[model samples]
Target: MTNSTRSGKRDRLAGAAVRVLHEQGVEKTTLADIARAADVPVGNVYYYFKTKDQLIEAAIAAHGHHLESVIATLERLPTPQERLKALVHSWVEQRDLAAKYGCPTGTLASELDKRDDGLDRAIAKVMGELLGWMERQFAAMGREDARELAVALMAAYQGISLLTNTFRDPALMEMEGHRLERWIDSLA
Candidate 1:
């Protein structure tokens, strides 16, 4: 196969890895599950990623790229407050999925954090990138304690996500999204 075709398959595998990992949790997700999700044969998964850790690494990279793209879009907003509100709104749009399966990154990171294999560190990098972006936004809003504001923003998001998932209530995300928007505006 051509290199592009090979990459297409690899990308598909990685995307499926993220979805499967999100839906089923990393520990319970098998190569077969990813293959089934990707609509490819099990051997095809090994051709791209030899082990579960490799797949997890690919998922982390995929999440990182996706997060960067999102931040890029958010950066286009007129102000830091608007950007931060847009971020919360976008996540709130995924309320149904969060209700069913939880915030994809947060859930995966929480689960992987308990392991000794260092995959946790890989996922943590994605979270760090997000934290850095939020910190910059807070700084743009003229907050001297940008890091603390970033942590607070993330805490509210993560806390609401947990409650939304735990209660299986999408409305909770809506309410918190509004509250977060107001909080961000107040800070601005």
Candidate 2:
């Protein structure tokens, strides 16, 4: 097969891994399941990912990249504060999506030390980039404690998101988001 075909097959497997992880949770998903879902042979799946952890790493990386793209597009709005609010609002609107699929990074991070070292590092790298981006934006707005504030805000956002997902209640999400927004505004 051509390189393009091979690459497409690999991507399809990775996407399937994401779906499996979302549907079955990381614990229940297996290489055979992913192969079946991708319609690829199990050995072929192994060709792309030496281990199940590698596949999970790819899925998490894909999710992180998708998130970064979404945030990057929204971050280009008028002012730093506007961009920040828009970021938070955009994330809140997508709470339903996470409710359906689970938070990929949070799922991995919660099991952080249990994950393969490489996978853990990759997830941490993505998170550091995101938090660092938030810090830079906040600092530009004259918030000297931007790093601490960014960490706090993201912690609140993630924590609230997990809570809302657990309860399956939009009201909880809205309450948490509104409180976070007010706190951010006070900081500004």
Candidate 3:
């Protein structure tokens, strides 16, 4: 295949892999399934990603980085308080984005965690980075135990997302967001 054709194929497969992972979860997704979803040959997926784990890891990284970028944009706000509010709003919005792609990184990480320690460790690092980012923002506002606060915030988010997924209720998700907003507002 021409280089251009190869690149296009790789992009298609990667995009399809993301879709498949989001729909089927990491445990159920397969290389052949990804190829079928992408409308490409099975060999093509292998060409781009050596293993399913590689594809999932890449997908999670891609999704996680996209989220981080969105959060980073909120940092331009004047005060850490505003930034934190923006963070909360951005998170709710981002989870909606994840709904389009299926479950977010949190779900993917939870599923794959049992099967692969390496991938689990990698996911943990990504989560740590995200939490660390939040910690810095809280610390800027003179909040103590910013890291612990970040972890609490993460727990709140993960719990809300999981519950929302289970119930398929947008209102519940909104309530969760508001509850978290209030909690953070209290902190501020």
Give one digit per residue, the lDDT tens place, for model 2 in 3-52: 99999988888888877877677788899999999999998887789998
- Stretches off by above 4 angstroms in model 1 are none
Count of backbone clashes, every candidate in sequence? 0, 0, 0
Instruction: Single out the weakest 10-residue window by summed lDDT for candidate 1.
Output: 37-46
TM-score of 3: 0.84
Q: Estimated TM-score per prediction? A: 0.98, 0.86, 0.84
Each candidate's root-mean-square deviation in Å?
Answer: 0.7, 2.2, 2.7
| Candidate 3 lDDT tens digits, 40-159 | 988767788898877877776766667678677877789877877777776677556444442466877787778845787777777777788889988997988888998898888877
How would you order the candidates by lDDT, starting with the best?
A: 1, 2, 3
- Error (Å) of candidate 1 at residue 61 is 0.7
Question: Each prediction's Cα lDDT score?
Answer: 0.92, 0.78, 0.76
Better of 1 and 3 by lDDT: 1
Query: Which residue pairs in candidate 2 collide?
Result: none
- Give the lDDT of residue 74 in candidate 2: 66
